[model samples]
Every structure is written in structure tokens, then in C-alpha cells.
Target: MKLLLLKTLLQRRARDEGFTLPMVIALGFVMILLGMTNIVKSSEENLNAITQNSSSDALAVAEVGITKYRELLNQNRILTIYNDDQWNTNANVTGQACNDLTTTPTGWEDGGTATAPNDTTKWWELREDTDGDGTDELIGEYRLVSYQYDIDDDDFDSSTPPTNNNGQFSPSDDNANTTDDFTFNDVTYDPLGVIGTSNSPEGYNPTGILTVQGRSTDGSEAQIKVEIPLRINQNDLENLDPALWIGSTDTTYLANLNGNLGSLTVTDGNVVIIDAASAGSSGCSDPADGASYTVISDAREVPSISSIASKRTEAVNAGINNSIPVTSPAVLGKTDDDPYVTPPSGATFDEDIHCANISDCRYYYDLSATDITAVTETDGIAKVTLYVDGNLNINQDLGSNVSSSYLEIYVTNSGSITIDSDSTNTINALIHAPESQLTVNGTGTVKINGSVWVDKFVNNATVEIEPDTTRISSLNTAPSYKLYSTATARTPRPLTGSPTNWVREEVQ
Candidate 1:
């Protein structure tokens, strides 16, 4: 009986051992499955990280393209005037970079076409030497998808509209209505017209918008829209506040003028009547009622002297450093004893400083001696900019022929500026002497055809001043002041929290 029990137990043990092998096999299989699952997940995570990195890179590349394009545009800007309005690159410009709109900087592809995205040639490869070993590694590529201008619909003249044929706005041929819909790259772009004239400084309206696509080597893409707004040219006198800007706040009868004020039918045209004190013995007449000139004693109208000085400094730095030494002979007899000429010493003035041949004609003076630096533009001169560090005396006619078209005088001292020329002389020049007092006491019927911005002004001379809008319009120079809109402030991107004004988005 005991032997039979042992056999039965052995059989049961054999069955139990067989069941253990199957369980172990099942466990091993389960472990293998988990390992495979983890491997797959790791691969997926790596791929996702790579894709995210590429997208980030593409976004950075898109921003870089915006900056690069802006730099190119600024460098290749060509503005044409139409009806006394500044039509920037977006307007009618011929034979220039803005002519075709397809022309780009050197090494940049011409992808301004409508199907720029499909064209592989339009891509500009972005490269950087990560190790700084000269051999640049390809980061990604970018393409200018579309460039369209936001025209001023209100400003468009239906009678004399500007033409835009094949992205070429011809100033010579005025045909196409600027407000009409223009097709570019198979897309009819609508005119995102200006806000208003009051908002625009000096009629500077918004230019246009640029769309660029940035693509990474991994096929990731990012698109950004960059708005190009109108930039204020500092040289353009239109940016100036008033025709005659007085920086002083002394309300003690500062003006004593009897000169006639007249304008060339400009926005703010008028004559002078500084009868607040007395016209003295000057033979000047006052303007009729409803004149165009402005008369405000508000201290808020005062412009900072530093701002005007900066403009003068900018011109000097831009290769206009022609020095007028003290030794230079003056047309008027220089009385060394009477450096401070309260009134004319009756000196015979017969000198003629002609600046017709020179282009810049910016003459600078650094005179330690208080001698009068007399200038008389007998011959028609180009845009002559004089930077006087001491006293300046204008005899005879000052830029009679050119008027305010090409004459600008910037005085940087408290010295006297004597206008001893007779009244027949037309002093057509823009004078900016914030620190000095301008004394207009010539005997002749002097006609001031330009603008004057001085600290203290004494109008004892019988004169006729017409605020020349041409003064600001004729000034076409560099070192401009870029006035951005409330939308885009000095940058292509929009301000935080004010996303409605400007549009910047990642389309891809």
C-alpha cells in the first residue's frame, strides 16, 4: 500500500514540473513584448523631438528672412514725388529696384513671382559654421512668397491715377487707378488703405507687406508676414512743426514784426504781425484776415534744441565737413574791434560765394574770433548747407534763384546772425539756429521765402515771409527719421497685446 502511494505522488510531481516550464516560457514571452514596446516608444519620442527642433529652426529662419528683406528694401528704396506727395518705393518708380519687384540683393533668388513656393530656385539657403571652421553647415532655406503694397485708397486720384503694370508703377504714365484691385501672383490684393491723414505724419502712408516662408532641411516650414510702413525722411522739411519755430517760452513780447506773411497755398500758409510789442520804424505791412500762418504762444509748440542739433550733426558726419576757417576773407569789411555788430557798420559787401558746382556744398565754420562770416549767393547754387559755429552775416541776396529749394543754414552758437541785405533780396533759405537770435534788420524789402527756426527773432526789417513747402519737399538726403505707426513701432513685428494693428502669424 505504501509503494502505491509513493508512485501516485511521483506522478503528481512530474505533472507539476511540466506546468512550471510552460509558465516560465509564457513569462519570458511577456518580458520580450514589453521590451519591444519600450523600444518603439523611444523611437517615436526621438522622431517627435527632431520634428519639434526643425519647426523651431524654421520659425527662427523666417524671422531672419524678415530682417534681411527689410535691410535690402531700405538699401534699395526709391521715392518719387507726385502732386507734392511722396510716393515711396511702392509708388511709381522706374528703372530702380522697385521697378520689377523681382530684383533682390546679390546672392538672393528672385522669388517674387506668384508661384514662388513651388519654384525650388527661389530658396535662399541659410548656412552657419557651427564649429567656426569656415565650412558652413546648411541650417535651412527661405523664400519670399509674396510682396504686396497697402495703397492709400483715399489718397488715390481717380483723374490722374498711378499705373502698376506687371508690378511696375510708372510715374511717367498715369493710367491705372491706385485704389483699384491689382493682381499679383494669381492673388487679387485689396488696398489696406491708410487710417487717416491726421494720423500720418507728413503724408507718409503705409507702404506694403512681405510674406516669407522658412523651411528646414527636415521639411518643416514656417511662414511670417512682415508689414513695411512709411519711413519719415529727416531731410524732408515736412516733418518740421512750424514754418517759424521759436524755442523760447519768454512771453514778454518776444515778437515785434510788421512783415507780410504769405504762403504758396500750402497746408498752413500765412504772414506775420508781431504787433504784440511794436513794429518799430519798419516799413512792413500786416497780412489780411483769414491768413494761413499759425500764431500760438503755447509752450507745448516748442521743439527741443537737441533734436535740431542732432540733424545738423548727422549732416556733418555724412561727409559734409568742409571747414570755413577764420582766415577766409569776408565780403563785408570785418571790424575785429566790433565783433558784436549790433547794427551794420556800413561796410561795402562785394563778395560772391558761388556753390553752383558743388553737390553737397556743406561748409562748416569753427571760428574762435567773433568776426562776421558773410555769405552772398549771387549765382544760383545747389543745395548749400552751411554750419556756422560763430556769427553769420547775410549781405545782398541769399539764394535768390534757388529760393528754399537748396539752401539750409544751421548755426550752433549764441552769436548774432545779421541780415543786412536790402528788402529787394529774396532770402530763400531754411535757417535753424536754436541757440542764436536771428535779427532781420536790413534796409531793403527783404523777402524771406523759406522757414526760420531760431531762439530769439527780431524782425525790424521790412520783409515778406512765405513758408515754402518746397523747402521741406526739396530736401532729399540721408539720416532720415523713421516714424512708425501705432501698429508697428520701429520693428516688423507687432506690439504685445496690440495684435489687431499688425498681422504676424505662423501659417505653417
Candidate 2:
């Protein structure tokens, strides 16, 4: 009887054992499913992180676009080849312009024209990684490029502006002194709405505003804007007093060493001499004075000849780097072969531009080899830059209708610039021939309006040069004529709108 009870108890124990094994198996299955669920969740998180990283990279690419433009508009790149012209109205870049310019003129005055004024908004792309290390990627490109012009800035927006450049943003006054520095018109823009009108506490320029948009291969993109005021006007250059910033390794004649052979009149500017002594033996006597003139003095405490040349070259390089690439020959002139002489009567700059619009524009001029040197301007228009690799014969009349700040003639690798205008009309331009001399001789009443810089000066006592501050500065517009860059100036735009200002959907 005891053995029978034992067997019955064993049977019960076996049934309980079977149920336990099944429970264990079911729990094991649940554990495996839970592990899989966690893995799936982690994978989703990784995917999201990857997406965010891509977006960030796209944003960086866009920022790079804006930065590229900023480098082009740097002020240091736009100084006249002479003077400490390094002499800037902006105190930050100036060591000296006048007696303590940092203290005088109070602050930066753009003279109504931007102190660092730029012309237009330029565009470009990021394709090759020139850095052999494979850092440069064939990412994306800028789709849109635009420049804004304040209606108040010389009213440049009027009368069919040169097609597709800049336009006025509003008509409200942007008085720099007033507390309400920004006034936005109740204008509606894209779905994004009128954005960041008062974004910058330091008001926007009444001259230039640059805009550029960049995209990446990943289909992500970004846009940026910046202020790029052009420093085109030279009238404010007075602070550099002796607007004539000259330097020489040898004597730069100011007055005939032997006698006051001819006459020169600097209505309201100072004369700065560098090197040996003043160009002429006798300091230029201001006719306005009682048969007396300002004494010739080396404005610089120590001659800054080499330093000036080096800096000027750097500035030129900067301008060239920042410019839009356009192919133009050094020699520009009247006939196809007469690039060294005056144009035929009916020839106009328009004609040259039309011809240059085609392929065979540059016949055989070589700037790298210094192949030619001579500028004999043709009559119809008053402005043109004849970059010769040899000598300059500037004997043309600058038409009466010459525009302010117009014409620039640069004679590179030259020994001298001889002048004998057929007509006495004033010829305006900024002539730079660092290694040459200037010799003026004309029977008719001759007048030259602008600055001449070279190794020396030799006047036949016939031509009188009157400083016309209005001549267009080649240094200021270096990119347009000498560089592969465009004529526009660009910088990172003002940051006006924050997340609070952007559309709710647009902000991350």
C-alpha cells in the first residue's frame, strides 16, 4: 500500500515538472522578442542622427559660400597704389591719414559713398578640391546672387539699371544718427515673410547688400546675406592730405631743379613727397598764395617705399582674387591693330565692348611677359584703361562729358609717359607706372586731371596737372580691369532675424 501511494505522488510530481518546462520555454521566447525590439529602436535613433548630420553639413557648405564673398570685399585690397593710401578713413586700417586721424574726423565717414563701398553681387561655385589631400568635394553651387541698393544711395536704381544687378529695398530714411535706425516698409516677401529688416544694430549700408545661396550634393541647401559697401569715392581721401601719395627710388621732380619752368595748381590738397626730395628742385608754389606755396616735405617720418609697393601689390592681389572672372586683354584701343593709338572718329567704348564680347578680343598682348606699353586714348569717350608693357603716349583729349571718377590708365614695365594732347582738354585718369617717369609737352593749353606715380618726373613746362579727385581709381576697381574676378563686392549679410523672427516651420 505504501508503494502504491509513492507511485501516485511521483505521477503528480511529473505533471508539475512538465508545466514548469513549458513556462521556462515561453519566458525565453519573450526575452528574445524584447531584445529585437530594443535593436529596432536603436537603429531608428542612428538613422535620425545621420539625417541631422547631413543637414548640418549642408548648412556649413552654405556658410562657406558667404565667407568666400567676404574675402573679396576686404578694404585692404582696394587702396590707390600710392600714399600710405594704406591711409584709410576707417581708423581700424589706418596708421595715419592726417594729424591723428584716429582722433580727428571723429569716426568713419564714407563721404555719402560707402567708405568700403562695393559695386555688385557676384556668383561662383565649389567644384574641385584644389587641396590635393582630397578635402575639396564636388558639393553644390550657388543658384542665386543679388545685390541690394538703398534708394538713397546716389539713386542708382533709376532709369533701366544695367540689367540684372541691384535694386532699392525701401524708401524709408536710414539716418545713421537716429535711434530708430531701421524702418521697414510694410512689404510682403516670400512665404518666409518680410524678414530681419532691423537685424543689425549697426545699420545696413545705403549702398550695397550681398546675397548668395549654396546647395550640397545631398539635396540640402542654405542662403546667406551680408553688407558689402563699396569704397569707390576718393574725395574723402583728403584726410590722407597731400592726396598725391608718391614714392621713388630716385628723384621725383616736383619743380624744375633749375627754374619754375611751368605752373601747377593744387586747389585744396597737400603734396606729399617721398624718397630723395620733392620731385622738382623748387617746391610747387601755389599760385593762389602770394607767389608762395607749401614747402615740399616727406610726409612720412621714414620712407615707406618698399613697404608701400609690397602692400599695394597685396591689395591688388586681394582685389583680383575677389573678382568675377572675365577675360580682357591688357591692350584696349581704336582699331583691331591700333590698340596703342587713338580711335577712329566714330569709335566708342561701346564698340570696343562689342568687339571684346567675342573671342579674338586680345590679339597678341601678354601681361605676364610685359610685351607692350603705350596708351593713346581715342576721342569718342573719356574713359578707358590702356595697359601697355612698354611706354605710354597719353596724347588724347578727355571729352568734356567725362563722368566723375572716370578713366584709369596703367602703364606697366615702362620707363616714361610722354604727353602731348592735340587739344588742351583736361585728361582725367589715375596713371601708375611705378618704375617710370612722366614727361609732359604740348603746344596747346594742356591740363591733366588726376595723379601720376612713377620713378621720376620730367615736365617740358607745357602741361599742367590739376588734381581731379573724381577720377575713377584703378586700385578701387582692380578686379574689373586687372583681375579674373568680377566687379561686385560681397560680405556676410547682417544677422537680423532669429528663431523668433523666422517662420515657425522654417526654423529647425
Candidate 3:
């Protein structure tokens, strides 16, 4: 009829374009191989997140060159690690870079090394903001490869690194006969494998394995290494000694002649009355019932059996930061803006005890040796142990005053040992308070040159402190318990032990 309806509309448009152009070229070739595997997995996850963020910033720049070379060799490893011969590699072929006086300074060395620091020293740069955003971020730099193992067996041989660098490090070559100095019990330890030594400000060193390197300015050079091993401490509280003050409890008049065990308070006329007091080799006639003071506890009743006890539980566990744990009594508050220098207003008891120059002082207490700034100091201790757990009132007024030089008063107090001085005082030192009760109330006359071991002994007043074996063997050499107990004494980790005390060895 009109050509049979145009052949059925061209056969229904060829079955509706059967498979349009090969299914649009096979779905555009599988979407271009899934967009090239997501662009090669986002370019290998941005090159493995930029090689794990430049290998965690080259190991935090090798732990900031092993903590600034263990704080520039433990703050003065005997004048900069015994004169650091510069660990070879031609010393400093111009490792130049890092001056910073404030031209915009405080951390960002060019990772210097082409060498160039003939003079003008002091350099440290490491910039890092970490997004807190004050503006820092430089990431990657370190130094101190002055490696000096000369061969102690830690390995660094990188094609022979030492080169016989002779600057100084002799303990008589390691003790061929002397020089090394060790001394166990009496406490010495000079050079001998070090970790302890201090005449006060003198120095010492011994654990320094070596190796510091670090890199990664970002080109992906990324490197790192550490190996450290440092530590230090050993002052045995100067020397330690109270020689003799044996006042087991007798109360004033002069503690039974000098030696003590008590049983003498003769009071017919208030007498210790040395009526012609001259008798040696056991002579000196005088009625019995002696003791003015001086009796070192235990006649046999033994409180805790002491020859002279009470190290205050081994100096409160070797944490003795020059202690002052009064517990109450307000712990002796000061505040006048307290920079120290406020104790003498009536002075019953208050000793700041750290007077570098508290108005030109003569040291009434141990000067700073440790306790370093005492984080928050509540009377911090360790200038060699002053542990006074509590009660040690020594009311002062001593106007005669006499301490020619050399003075040490450890006073391991726990309670009671009062001496209300009125004037004319003389306590040369070595007064070990075995565990309390030994009062000597005021009106003053006190003169105890050296030695005192108390427990229960009251000497009404008028002074004491007598046994002086050549000045208590030149003032004890620190032994009889440097902190013995609480599991084998401590307080000399030397330098790198641990918060809980570690490091007899740590290779990595």
C-alpha cells in the first residue's frame, strides 16, 4: 500500500542498533584500564607517603644527633670530652654553617660539612614546627661523628675511621699500675672505668660508645644512626663523719665526761664538777652517778642495735635532694619574694641551704652539687645528703661563733635533737641522730668539736660534741652506707641509667 509501510520501518531500525559500535569500544577499553590503576595507585601512594615521610624525618634527625651529643658530652666531659680530637675525617673540613647570634636564629643548620669553623664556635639548629604553627619546619640535619672508639669493640670501621687521634684519655693506659683509681668501699672511682668522680666541680667521663649521623633535606637521601651510651654521678656526700657524740640520753652538764652509756646526773649541788678534773690512764677520783650527755643508745637494751644508726632509711631511698620533709610546721614557708636570704629574723630554724653568695655566706649548709635547680624544690637535697625527715630545731644565737674552715653536718634527723642555743656555739660536725631524743635547751655554751650519735640523751644546755680522731679521720670518706638497702644502694648512675635505673649496657 505505500510500499508496504516502508518495509516495516527499515526492519525496526536494525533491531535497534544491535551492539552499538562494539559496545562503545568495549566500554572505552575498561575505562582506560581503570584509569591506569588509579594512576598507579596514586603514584604509589605518593611514593609511599614520601618514603614514610622521609623515613620519619630521617629518624628525627637521628634523635637530634643523639640529644645534642649527649648534651655536648655531659656538660663538660672533662673539658669537652677530654679535648675532642675531632674524631678524624680531617676534623672539620669546613662542616661550616650555623652561627646564629640572632640574625634570625635558634635552629636550622644547612646540615653543614664542606668544613669551615676555624673559630667563632657554638652551633645548633634544627627547626621544626609540626603544625602548631609558629613557623619552623625544616626537617633533617645532625652531626657529631667525632667517633672515638679507637677500638673498644662497638664497630665503626667505615674503611678505618679512628686514625690514632691522640688528645688524651689515659688511666695509665687503663691501669698498668695506678692512675685508674677504683677504691670500692671507702668510695674512690676516679678514672677506673668511670661513672663516678667529683671533688665538687672537677669532672669525669666513661660511657660514650659513639655514632650520631642524620640526614634528609628531602631529596630522599634519608639516613640515620645513633648508638649512644653516656651517664655520670659520684660525690659520696663529700666524705661523711660524725666521729663521736655518744649521747644515748643523759641531759646536759657535758654528757658523762666524753664516752657514753649514761647513769650520771649527780645533783647534790648541780655537779659534773671536774673538781681537779685531771686524770689519764684511768685515774681521776670523783663520786659516781655520771653522764652530762653522750650515750649512743643500746647499753644492751638495744633499740634497733646501733653503733650509730639511722641513715634515715638509707637517705629516704637515695633520693635525698638535700631534704627538708618536715611534713608540717608549714615546711618553713618564706615569701618576701624569697630568692633566699631571709632566715635570720629570730632564727629558730630556717636554712635555705644553697647560698652561692647569699650575701657572702660561709656555707651553713651543703652548696649545690646536685638537685639541679630542683624542678620545684620543696627543700631539695643532694648536695651529698642532708636528709632531715623532721624535727631538728637548733634555736640559734651563737655569737661567739667558731668554724675555722672545714665543716659538715649531715644530721640524718627523723625527730628530736633540739639545742636552743643562746650564744657561744661550737659544733665542728659529725652529729648522727640515730633516731631522736637528744635535747640541749638554750642559755648557750655549746662546744662539740666533732662526733655525736644520739637516741635518748638530754643535756640541759651548756654544750657538747667531743670525739675527734684527728678530726674524725679527716671527716669520713663516705661509706658505711652510701644508700645501702632498698635493694642494694644507688645514687650514682653516673649518667645514663634510667628513670627506674638501668644501663649496665645498652648497645643500640
Candidate 4:
């Protein structure tokens, strides 16, 4: 009965041990799978790190290489010439036998033996004759033996050959057939020469800047570049002080002016003052409004009588004014028969005279006249004093045949000079100093074909033109900048202490 109880205890112990075996196996399998996964992940991370490091190194090397190439191109010497002839025949081989032996040997037999007999007195002569004559004859003669020894066989088999008199393989011949026929076309041989290509990367433009120490074409050691930008602004225009922009809105004046009416000051007043003539009627007057004027102010100031008279004279002389009729010579001579009546010489006196021809009359100078007519010179200088009772007219023939001097016209103490021209008639005047302020006052028009350089001030000047037109242009344009690149070489040296690598960098 005790033995049976011990047997039941043993059976229960076996059942527990069965579950323990499966648990230990499962734990071992999980440990193995976890270890393998860790190993694979660690390997992948290591590989990725190595790849990143390699890419960085490669990028640096490529950049350096490109820079080095640029420097090489920029250098003075760039190309080297090994051979320049179209058909260079210079052989680069040495220790080459000239011909084949054994087959058609003059002194060599088919067997590995010499033709000279033993103990022969002419052995030296035979050897020499065989070496010289046999080589010449064998190479010069044509044969049809087999592809191995045949020079005429287009499809010569080089794999199989006879033991003797077989054609030997020559590296020089192979090089000649493969590489020696190279011909350079349109090649420029320059040392330190620059070359360009259109294969640049997008948005990556290369430019070179060279700071040379030697003298330049201007005989100065200066900084020169292929590219430069130029800018022009309002400051530059201000410095030049062109006449077109002078004193219109940029000038200041005195604040006050005293007058006879209780010493009238010009403070905050728009009226200007006109001084009276202390002498005679030689002074100017306001326009007739049927009122007897004692003194005149800026508000009553009017165009001078002299200016109007000058313009009238100019129009009459130019044959544009028909109101003033010119009488015939015979009629004028009859009226001036007395010759010494001496008409009253006043400011408004109209003197009538007779001339045999228009050239016989002298230039009239009356400051109160409407117009005066004159001619100019071919040499661009017109010198004429115009005293206008109305308007002034420059009716001068401008040429060397008419006038040999410059055209200089003066509007002397008169009204404005009006430059008028028809399609067939044109007037060019170079006005100089005037007694009063000169004005280009006219309802009629004037045009200048050439540039006018004004060295003096023009009061109340007006330049009328068609709307929206270009006023000026550059007579000579300036140059612009450009960019270029070149390549150069650096000295070859070891990259560290090792002889395997080299050091390359762009110096400039």
C-alpha cells in the first residue's frame, strides 16, 4: 500500500515537469529572435552612417575638382602639343627585327641550323651576308605561303602559326593601327588657355575675378574685372547744371522793394515796380488806356514800343508784311529831288529813300521799330545790332559765300525777337548780350535742328514742343561689363605622407 502511494506522487511530478519543458523552449526562441533583430538594425544604421559620410566626402571632392579645373583653364599655358603633323610617321618603337627567318632564309635552313659549314674560314662573312642580305630579301619579297606568314591575307589568323618563320606580334604595329592615326581637327594649342562649354548646371554661373599686379593698358596697376555695373542718378544731373533746369523754381529773391507811394514795400505783395525815366520821353510807357498816367507799377507794365517796331521792321524786310508798301525807285527819287529838305528827325519819323539796288541800302538801327532783317555767315557767326520798332527778323543767308564770319545777332533795347521761317526760308541766329532782358516771345514758331548750348540765363524763356517727345539722347554710349572664366594647373604633390592621393585646391 505504501509503494502504490509513492507511484502516484511520481506521476504528478512528471505532469508538472512537462509544462516546464515547453516554457523553457519558448523563452529560448524569443531570445534568439530578439537578438537577430537587434543585429540587423545595428548593421543597417552603421551602413547608413557610412553612406552619409561618403556622400559628404564626395561632394567636397567634386567641388574642389571643379575649382581646380577653373584655375587650370585660367592659367597662361593650357595645351600641350605632342604631334602636329596630319600624317605623323615617327615610330615609337625600339629593338624591332626587320624581317622573318626560316621560310625564305638565304643562309638559314628549315631546321634550327645555320647555312655556314663547320670549321669554315668564311663563317664570319657568311653570317654577315645572311644577316644583311637575307633580311632585306625576305622583307622585300612577296609570299603566298599561309595566313601565319602572309602579309597579303586580309583575314590573317593569329591564333595558329608554324614553329619557324611565323610573324611575331608587335605592340608598335598594334598602336599604329589603333591610335597613331589620330588627327586633331581645328585644335588651338595654347598654354594657360581658357575654354567654355554650355553644359553648366542650371542657375550656377561661373565668373572669374583677376587682380593683376602688373601695369595695364592705361599704364596703371589697377583693378580690372570682366563684369561691372554702372549707375546714373539725379545727383549726376545736378552736378552738370544743365540749362534746361536752371532757376525756374529753384531761385530765391529779396523780400521787399520801396516805391514813391509812402515807400511801398513788396512784403506779401504780388505787384513789381518800374522806375520812371528822370530824363525825357526816352523812358518806356504803359499801353494807352485813355488815362494820363503819372507813374507806372508792375501791374501796368506793358510791352515796349521799341519791341513792337522792331518786329514790324523785321516782317516788312522779310516781305511778310504787306501793310507797308515799298515804292518804286523812280517815284522815290522824284520825291527826294530837294536832297537837303532834311525831314524832322523824331522817334516816329518815317524816312523814305531811293536806292539803285537793295545792296545800296545800309542796315537800319531804330530801337523802337517792330522788326529788323539781317543775314548770317556760313561760318556760324552772325553779328548784327537790331533796333526793333516792332519785331526782329533774322533773314540772313548762312554760307561762306554770303558771310565769312560767325552769326551774332543782338536785340538792342527792344521788344522780343520773333524767329519765323517758311518752308523755303529758314533763319539761324546766335544771339549774344542784349541791352534788356531778351525773350523768345512769339506766337509764330521756331525750330532748332542742332543742339543749343546756352552759357547764359534766359528770363521768361519758353521752349514749346509737340507733346510727348524725347528731348535728349546720348551722343556716345558707354561700354558695359562682361564675365569670363579660365583654367590653370597646380603642382602635383602627395596628399599627406602617402603617395597614393594628391592635394588639389583653388588658390584664387
Best model per lDDT: 1
Candidate 4 lDDT, tens digit per residue, 174-210? 0111222211111222323333322221211111211
Candidate 1 per-residue lDDT, tens place, 301-372, comes to 222222121122322323211233222322112111111122246643221332233332323333333444
Clashes in each model (backbone N, CA, C under 3 Å)? Answer: 10, 35, 51, 61
The root-mean-square deviation over C-alpha atoms between each candidate and the true structure, in angstroms, is 22.9, 23.9, 25.2, 39.6
lDDT of each: 0.45, 0.38, 0.36, 0.24
Candidate 2 segments exceeding 4 Å error: 1-236, 241-246, 249-261, 275-296, 299-374, 378-383, 421-425, 471-508
TM-score of 2: 0.32
TM-score of each: 0.36, 0.32, 0.25, 0.17
- 2 or 3: which has the higher TM-score? 2
**Ranking, lDDT, top scorer first:** 1, 2, 3, 4
Span of ten consecutive residues with least summed lDDT in model 2: 303-312
Residue-pair clash count for candidate 4: 61
Candidate achieving the largest TM-score: 1
Q: What is the lDDT of residue 492 in candidate 3?
A: 27
- TM-score: the better of candidates 1 and 3: 1
TM-score of 1: 0.36
Model 3: what TM-score?
A: 0.25
TM-score rank order: 1, 2, 3, 4
